[model samples]
Target chain A: MIDAIVLRDAREHWRMLLSWAITAAALISLQLSVYPTVRESSAGLQQFIEQYPEVFKKVFRIEDYTSAPGYLGTELFSLMLPLVFIAVGAAWGSGFTAEEEEQGTADLLFALPVSRVRVMLAKGAAAFLSLTAVGIVCLGTLAVGTGWVDMSIGWRRLAAGTAVCVALGALFCALGALLGAATGRKGAALGISVGLALALFVLYSLAPLVNTFDAALPYNPFQWTLGSDPLTTAFTPGSVLKPVGVAILALAGAIAVFQRRDLRQL
Target chain B: MTTAPKVTPLRALPPAEPVLEVRGLSKWYGRTHALDALSLTVQPGEVVGFVGPNGAGKSTTLRILMGLVSPSGGTADILGQSALNGSPNVRSAVGYLPGSPALYPRPTSRECLRFLQRVRGIDCRARVAELSARLEVDLEKHIHDLSRGNKQKIALIAALMHSPRLLLLDEPTSGLDPLVQREVERVLREAAADGVGILLSSHVLSEVEALADRVVMLHQGRTVLSAAMADITGRLVQRLTFEFADTAAESWFEGVRGVAAVEAHARHVEVTVNGSQAAALDAAAKHGVIAVHSHEQRLEDVFTELIPERAA
Candidate 1:
């Protein structure tokens, strides 16, 4: 069973989550509505895609842009979907315990019968669940939109793509919360998490253009989630293992740090 | 699942371990000493008044017991368990009210209390309603909509609603009006009757004087005084000012047994007495004193007199 604290957090911040969901749903609907037009103009797209340099094609993963998987990957799964979920993770996770301390509610909060580790873990879980809810909304929108757009891509691939977003979201969520738990500063948590996420995105984006960055792609988190290309290729549990492991490590660090440190005096 | 490390129980012994106990507790932040070798204990059903001026480490001591802040040294035992790394079960048996209740404004008072009740895995609805009525708090209003005093009242309700065996309250009624403070005092008295041990810290010594069975005064993170309420009050002197119908003479109170001194000018007489005011008071009445006003010694007066000698 989920901790009541998780439900409390979700209830407290549902408006933010709903806004994120509406944006994701709207973006996906607008993207899918153009797939039929792109597929009908495939002959012109092939010549148009060929005129670009191989560097441009490789950097953007612009292969078979007229196809269902490529159209979805280039426009949806690769950047927008993952980034939206990462935003969800970062926003919800950055305030795990730091917000309570800063707002002076920590006195009443820690005064309860719950352990510090339990509260930290519950908040982390709540952040993950919020991101997962957004991912579900994306999945549901994609599943329904596929039928309308006449895209042959199956729902399993959509689920696999969304699961990748969820796993990647968990890693950033854990990192955001770890910063909050260790520093007791929400700004540090939010700024550093979003900054680190953008840095990772830029590094992964330039890997194909820069030889040195290409060498580090094996270690890049974007490689572990998006680099697998779940939409066009086979989806396997092995793809998520690395990101899940890193997420667990970050969460464990958060729990250990929060459990022993003296809270803000307030 | 991995098993946790085991340790032996604490060594020092008490005949009957108190609900809350602290021995030689100290906390230092960088170069500043927040607490230094302070000690206290509260037995079941006992109301211990924790009194001190600002920076006396009174709030620090309570925070240490509540496990919000860690002590640099010594032990704080709650329900016979160590407070430093006590299990959450210890918190279940304790209720704590901070000097100020800093709550988020988005939620109503009822919502905030309900969130806490859910976390504690207990149903405090009945207790919440009862406390709200007694304290005259509006549970329906948002926390920000309430005044500071009303917020304090809601906080008091949250702390007391769970009915814990032990309570640590720091300036529980600081922002409350006299009427509300009286209501809070009534609630605390009733809690004590149910065998709840309370460690109450306050700058308002008069409120402590009204309710505490034992009073502990802290000075510079040290216990300066600890005694029964009767013991300290016994040694304190009382002064009386009288408005007389006719001219009074200082010689009239000269032979009064308990009268320490007397001054009479025109129709006004002031007499100082130790212990009982009966003998000196009767002596002044015989001298045509029409109206009398007796002033009891305040803790601040006693504290001020002690600080000059003790701080050194």
Candidate 2:
């Protein structure tokens, strides 16, 4: 039953999938066209990397930037993935309950034969499917883009990074669902989702500068996207645990809130 | 010849133990009491009309029953289940159509209905088709593209498709066109006749008069009056206008037992009185009721009187 609801939601929100595909295609095409020239100027690139290590590190992890798979994995999966997930989460959060109320569908939805928890669960499942699909497209696009650069890809590292990206996306998805269940207003839910993600991003970027927060790196899902090693090594359970745990907890909280909330509006 | 399978009589069918029993239900939003000790019982196959004005607590009561909103002070059982007991089973057996109908516009009508049906564990294509045809809903249209009335029709189909034992409909006809409205009314009546317990809320007096056997009037969230339509109407005073035997004859009815008021003119006397025409006839006979004409108070008049003008 949960799967059915999720699948139905995906089919209903297929427009999101189409939009994600278009963006991913454009990004992959741009990378394939530009990265070859950058890689050929190894000495210049090395000098540039040395000249502004912080900027290089900020954009792409310099240690793994030599291999096209490594560079794209960090730059695309790490930085770009979060942005995509945040956009998706924002859309899901605002559209979930608020749209129903705004359109007057919430009233009819709550009146149905299914429980509110089940409805939220279905919505979460659909969002998860969408976010996962986005991650897959990201991974696939990068893999094809790697071929264009004549770079041999390390499958293990890409998979680990993609998994973490998907997990963090799921976290946002769950939060978005919770925000949706909390209120019937679209702008409010959207603000909460976007605001929370932006704050987290700021905290993450400034973490190295904050002396007190330096010790909390392991707990952050953002660190998981900064790929360490691939092909030769599998992902560490330690790095994956936090995102998986947070996603699970967020989903549970969403269900809890949904069960008791009036949802009388839609 | 072999006996055909016999269907049980509607009345003989046992009441599905009051899925929702509203008792002394009262709700107050801040200083205003939206529902004032309103109570009603919904038995299987009984379609009860909850009629009241805009501010009446019809929506509040339904919201409480669905566990969407908590009542300030009241108890209700949904399919013999209570929210306190942690039972979601009531939802499984219930189908509701709120005063306002809304759905996820991203899906086509078919997708929305199919999702609802799957969750309810009912293969309801036939049921959906039945209601769709009756409501004249275009299932192929994307919900976003559909008009308000069409959206309501979709909601009605969704609610009825599952064939729930208890249905709570609030202003189900508000957005529907007259033809579609009649179709919805017919469907509701048929559902009741088929033994589905229904509680319908509407301020459209004529619709209520057509669809409900009993009317429960809510005033300030409290049930001001609830009775079989005939009984309430029977008890209310009717207006009696007669060409008085003489203009002076109106004064003679001032002290009559059943006559509450009399307005006399040169050619006619209009007397408002309680009870049957026999009482008025008997009283007027004494004064030579030469051309007595009577108009019984309708359900609308009784409804108006029961709920104070300001409260309504």
Candidate 3:
């Protein structure tokens, strides 16, 4: 296990990984605990939701707040859950190579017998595993919450939604790794990662306001992950496959660039 | 009465195969030339000291041999395998300490050693313990909390624990105190005795003179000189101070065959002899030399003369 870079990374970053998992679990639990309160005041809450602006409701995906999946989607998975996963993915990807180079440790690492491609793959595996861990924590909390609240939410649908979240998280993680490998600078990688994430999210959120962007919804990662509201809509292969495919392409490009480029010191 | 024995001409023997061989290695970083057709070899059980100023390509040469960087031209081989490809089997036989080694800051020294051991596929727990004990390194201390000297000890242990066939050390004693440096020198000598070929790059000329079997000097990314330690010793200048019965004119020694430079005072004369001291002493005796004293040449002086630009 120590020989594999992925396991090594996990061992080194266990504290951060655990913190992310706990954060995801805590957020999900808090959102689920408020379900009964929201249900009891459904009539008044529906009145308040109706008064919300049309664009605001569209951006937040607010529809039938009394429904379990809809409530969870808005309160948990929609923004908060994906945000947690995105941050985790971006951090892992950037820290893998960029942080090592910045800290002057790349020379020690690259001097080993292992090829650079293998090292990059190991880092990608670690990031994927960490993101999956956070997704699992969120899924487990949602499952337990449903049982505690006696909600009629299907476990199968919850599992499917969590899978989509993992894929979406992986896309951003790959993006961060690509930028880090190309630039060898943690700040640049992370800044571009967060900026792109925000830009794609805004583009997807305001798609209804612009006809051209609405037509380009298929190209937006945010639309791929949040467009269908995985909890309420039927699972589509395109939703998961497109993001996963894009992630693979990004990772391939990263590996190629890293292979040819010289490793620089801080 | 004794008679001189008959002398016979000696025949040159074939050269032995080198444990490490580099040929015409060149590295260019855009418009900058880091190394220019540098070639060298280290035979088994030999320690070759690489001496140069900063940016003189000592680190670049070592890095290329370790496969950390690719050369723009030429090839490097260790144990008959190309270092550029750096197969695992080939790398497992090599121990390298970079100019500035960086270990994981979070792990203890022991953990880092264990991780490297696993990576290298060496089952030498006893060796690790022995190296740590010899180096006086506390294995349980976190790397970030350790002093620079202690950190250097850990790096040294990691490089030596594997007992590799070839050791590529760059400034191995940079942060070490005198005692630790002596200890490390002892370890290197022991490794050499056991037939490990070592290529040590350092700016410390005295250490190089003390430990190297051969010295290779680099200047401005080029090999300025490569000579056996004995040859260097033979060519080393000797400073001769003479007190003549009478004032000796500097011109009296100006035409001496072995004297490189001469200085004359009212009653004392000093001459730097690069060849036989006998030749210079013979010339000084003609000036009615009353007394003579000689000082052995220092490697620092030789280094300055070899790389005069650096001295400037």
Q: Is candidate 2 or candidate 3 better by DockQ?
A: 2
DockQ values of all predictions: 0.39, 0.46, 0.28
* Model 2 complex DockQ against the native: 0.46
Candidate 2: lDDT over CA atoms?
A: 0.71
lDDT at position A21, candidate 2: 66
Candidate 3 ranges with C-alpha deviation above 4 Å: A1-3, B1-15, B244-257, B282-291, B309-312
Candidate 1 C-alpha lDDT tens digits along A18-44: 999999999999999998889899889
> Candidate 2's error at A166, in angstroms?
1.1
Candidate 2 per-residue lDDT, tens place, A169-266, comes to 77776677677767766777778877877776665666666755446655556665443333325777655567667777877876777666655453
Query: Residues B256-275, candidate 3, lDDT per residue (tens digit)?
Result: 89898899998889999887
Residue lDDT tens for model 2, B1-312:
111112122222235565457788877778999888877887777778898878788887887787777777868876666633333555666778877766777778997888777655667899888889889888988989999889888888877887877788988888889998888888888888887889989878888878777789887677878898667766878888877556656766777778888888886778998875666677777776678777876668877777877766
- Candidate 3 lDDT, A120-236, residue by residue in tens: 877888888878887778788889988898777898778878877888888988998899989998888988997898888888888887888889898998788778678888888
- The Cα RMSD of model 2 versus the native structure comes to 5.0
Chain B TM-score, all predictions listed: 0.83, 0.85, 0.89
Docking class of 3: acceptable
Best candidate according to lDDT = 1
